[model samples]
Target: MSQTTARSAPSKSDIAVVPPRRPSPWRDRLSRLDVKASPYLYIAPFFLVFGVVGLFPLLYTGYVSLFDWELGDDNPVFIGFDNYVELFGDDQFYKTLTNTVSIFLLSSGPQIVIAVLLAALLNARLRMPTAWRVGVLLPYAASLVAIGIIFANLFGPNYGLVNSVFELLGLDRVDWQANRFASHIAIAIMVNWRWTGYNALIILAAMKAIPREIYEAAWVDGASPMRRFFSITLPLLRPTLIFVVVTSTIGGLQIFTEPKLFDAMPGSNNGGSTNQFQTVTLYMYQTAFEGQHFGYASATAWVLFLVILVIASLNFLLTRRLVR
Candidate 1:
C-alpha cells in the first residue's frame, strides 16, 4: 500500500530574510584610533619625565662643556672645545683618571667573585633561607656615609682594628690613608662589602629562575653539586652575570663618596695627602665647586661618560664571548 505524506504550509516569518546591519563608521574609526594611540599614550609620561630630568640635563651639560663657563658667572663666554683641550693637557686629570681606573680594578673583580660565591651558598638548602637572604642585603640598605665612616676608622693606620690585627700577626702597620694603593684597597673593601650582598641577591634570583628539570637530570647522571653548578648553573646565569658586571663597572668607575670620606687626614679634600685616591668624580666635584671651573668639570664628566659607555660595551661583548 502507498501512503501520501502531507507537508505543512510555510509561515511568513520562515520566508522572510534579514540583511546584515551596516558597520558604524564612527565606531570603527574610534576602535582603530584606540588601537593606534593607546600604546603611545601609556608610554608618554615616561618620555616626558625623562626629557625634563634626564635628557635635558645631559644635552645641557654637553652644551655647557663647550664654553668657558664658571660658577656664578652671568655672561659665559662661548669657547668651542677649549675646556676639553685643557682637560686633555691637565696633569691632574690624568692622575684622577688613573686613580679611578685603579680603584675600579681593585673592586670590580673581587666583588663579582664574592657575589657569585655568596649566591651559590645561598642557593643551597638552608634553615631560614629568607632570613639569610634579607640579612645579606642589610649592608646595602645601610647609609653609604655611615659605611664609609666605619671603614675609615677600621682602616686607620694607628689604633684601627685592621692595624691591630696586623700587629698581632707580627706585621708592620700599613698606612691606608697616606698610601695610595693602600687607600684604594681600603675603598675597594668598602665597595665590595656594601655591594656584594646586593649582587648576590640578584644572582640568587637568577639561579632560582633556572629550570629544575635540567638539574634533576644532571643529578641522575651522577653530577656532583660543584659539577652541576659549573656545568648547568653557571652557563644558565650568563645574562645575569653580564648585567652584574656592567653595573659594577659603571659604579666602580664613578666611585666618589667612599674615597672622599675614607680620607681620615685632617682638612684634606683631595682624596689623600697628595691626591692619592682621588677618583674622577671626586676631582670633577672639586673642579666644579672649589675651582669654579664648571665648563672644565662638564668636559670631565662627558669624558667619563664616554669612558663608561665604552667600558660597559666592552664588558658586554667580552662576557657574551666568555660565557659561551
Candidate 2:
C-alpha cells in the first residue's frame, strides 16, 4: 500500500467518439416524397388514360344527348332532356327495350348454366386436357361475322338446316326471323354457342386457383364429388361467379351483332319486317346512322348504360348471396 503509485486518468484521445452525420435537406425531401406520393404516381397513368378515353367519352355523350344533334345539322340545337323524354314515350323504343330484355334473359340464363356444367366437365380428370381446353375456346376465337353468317343460314326459315331437321321430326318449320320469340330463341342459341365455352374456360381458371388440400380433405371425409363442388368449390368461387354473371349481364344487354346479322333483309337496319327482334344497340345504330338522330341515339345509349349498370349490380349481389 505504501509503494502504490497514482494512476493517470484516461484522456479524450484514448476514447474518441465519432459524431453523427447531418441529414441532407434534399434526401429528407426525397424520402418524404416517396412515402407520400409514390403510390399515387404509380397509379396516375391508369387514371389519366381512363379520364381521356373512358370518362371523357361518357361525359361528352351525356352532353350530346342534351342537344338535337342530327347528322346534317350545321348547329346542334340544345334541347335539355327532350331526347330522353321523347325516348321514354316512344312506342318503338319500348318495343326495342322489350326485345333487348327478352333476348338478354334467354341468352344469359342458359349461358351461365351451360358454362357452369361445361366448366365442371373440363375440371375433371380427362384425356388430353390441353386439347379439350383449346377446343372449347375455338368457337370464341372464330370470326363473329362468319359465325353470324353461318348461324343466319342455319336458322333461315326456308331450307335451313334447323328447319330441315324440324321437318324430318314432323315438327312445323320455325320462322326464326319473323316471329319475335322464335328470333330471340335463335339469337340466344347463337350467343350461347359463341360464349358458353369462353365463360367455361374463365370458370375453369378460377377452379384451378382453388386449394387442392381442401378438396382432398373433403374427399377423405367421404364427401361425394357433387358435395365437394357445392360445399367447398362454389362457396370459394363466389367472386369469380359474380364476375362472370355481371359481365354476362352487361354483354347480354348490349347485344348487337348477332341480332343485326340475323336480319334476313340485306342492308336493312330495322330488326325485322316489324322490328320485332331489334335490340337497344341495334335500335341506337338505326337511330344514329340510318335515321341520323344522333341526340336521340345518345339518349338511348345512356339509358342502356344505366340499365346495364343496374342489372349488373343486381346480378352481383344476388349471385354473392346465393353462393353463400
Candidate 3:
C-alpha cells in the first residue's frame, strides 16, 4: 500500500447531519406574554366594573359622610365625625336599631324551624314530588311587591284574613300593626312566608348530598327517623347550616322593600308611627331623601354597614367554634 493512500483512508466515520430545531405548537400559536396573562385578563373585567360602580361609590359616600353635606350646598362643610357623633347620640337611631333586631329575632327563629321541617318532609318520597317542590317555591317566585301588598291586606286591623280567622275561632281580634309585639309578629310572619321555602330548598339540597349508606347503617341499628336526623343528618349538615345562617342574617339585616311597601296606611314611609317598625335602611332613606340630612344619612349608613360586618363576623366565629 502507498503511503498517500493509507493516509487518505485513515479518517474514522463521518459526522451525521443535524436537522434544525422545530418550535412548539403552543408557543407558535400564542405570544409568551399572552399565554402568561390570559387567566388574569379573563377575570379583570368583573373587578374593573366593581371598582367603577361599587368601590368608588362606597369610598365617595364615606368621604361625603365626613362633611355637613346636603343637596344644593355651595360648598360642603368639612365636619370631622360630627355626623357620626350625632348619629350615636340620637334616640331615634337606637329605636330603629332595636326595632331591626326585634324583627330579626322574631322572624329568624320560626323561619329556621319551618325551613328545616319542610325540608325534612320534602326529603321523603311523595306521591306528587314535582308538584310539591313547585308549590313550596311558589311564594319565593312571587314578586316582592305583590307579596307585600297581599300580606298587608291579610294583616289589616279590620277585615283582615288573620283577624277573620281569629273571630271564627272565638278569639279576640288582635291588632297586628298597632301593638309593638304584634307589629313585630306580623312582619315576622311575612318574612317567614316569603323565605321559608327558599331556605328549605337549600337545606334539602344539603340533605340529598348525604350518603345513603350512613342512613342505612343507622336504620339497621334500629335508629328512628327522628333519631337518625339528629344523630346523622344534622351533624353532617353543619357547614351548610352555617352558610344558611350567615346569608340569612345578612339578608334579614338588609330588608327594606317589604316593610316599606307593606305598611297599610297610605303614604307612610317612616316604617310606622313613631318608627316602630323602622330598619336602619329605612331610617337612612328617610333621613337622606325626606329630611334631606345628607351627611348624617351617609354617617348612619356607614355605621349600619360596620354593625352588619361586625355582627356577621361574630356570628361566623361563634358558629364555627360551636361546630368544632
Q: Quantify all predictions' global Cα lDDT against the true fold.
A: 0.90, 0.91, 0.84
Per-residue lDDT of candidate 1, residues 1-324 (tens digit): 111211254445433422246446797898899999999999999999999999998999999999899999999999999999998999888999999999998999899888989999999999999999999999999999999899999999888999999999999999998888888999999999999999999999999999999999999999999899889988899999999999999999999889889987643458987889989999999889888989989999999999999999999999888876
Candidate 3, poorest ten consecutive residues by summed lDDT: 11-20
How well is each residue in 195-239 modelled by candidate 3, as lDDT tens digits? 999999999999999999999999999999989988898878788
TM-score of each: 0.91, 0.90, 0.88
Q: List, in order, the clash count of every candidate structure.
A: 0, 0, 0
Which parts of model 2 are misplaced by more than 4 Å? 1-23
User: With candidate 1 superimposed using the best TM-score fit, by how many Å does residue 314's alpha carbon deviate from the native?
Assistant: 0.7
Off by over 4 Å in 1: 1-27, 265-268
Q: State the local distance difference test value for candidate 3.
A: 0.84
Report the number of backbone clashes for model 1: 0
Residues 1-324, model 2: lDDT tens digits: 212322354446433422246446798899999999999999999999999999999999999999999998999999999999999999998999999999999999999888888988999999999999999999999998889889999999997999999999999999998899999999999898999999999999999999999999999999998999899888988898999999999999999999999999876778999999999999999999998999999999999999999989999889988998
Write the candidate numbers in order of decreasing TM-score: 1, 2, 3
lDDT comparing candidate 2 with the true structure: 0.91
Global CA lDDT of candidate 1, please? 0.90
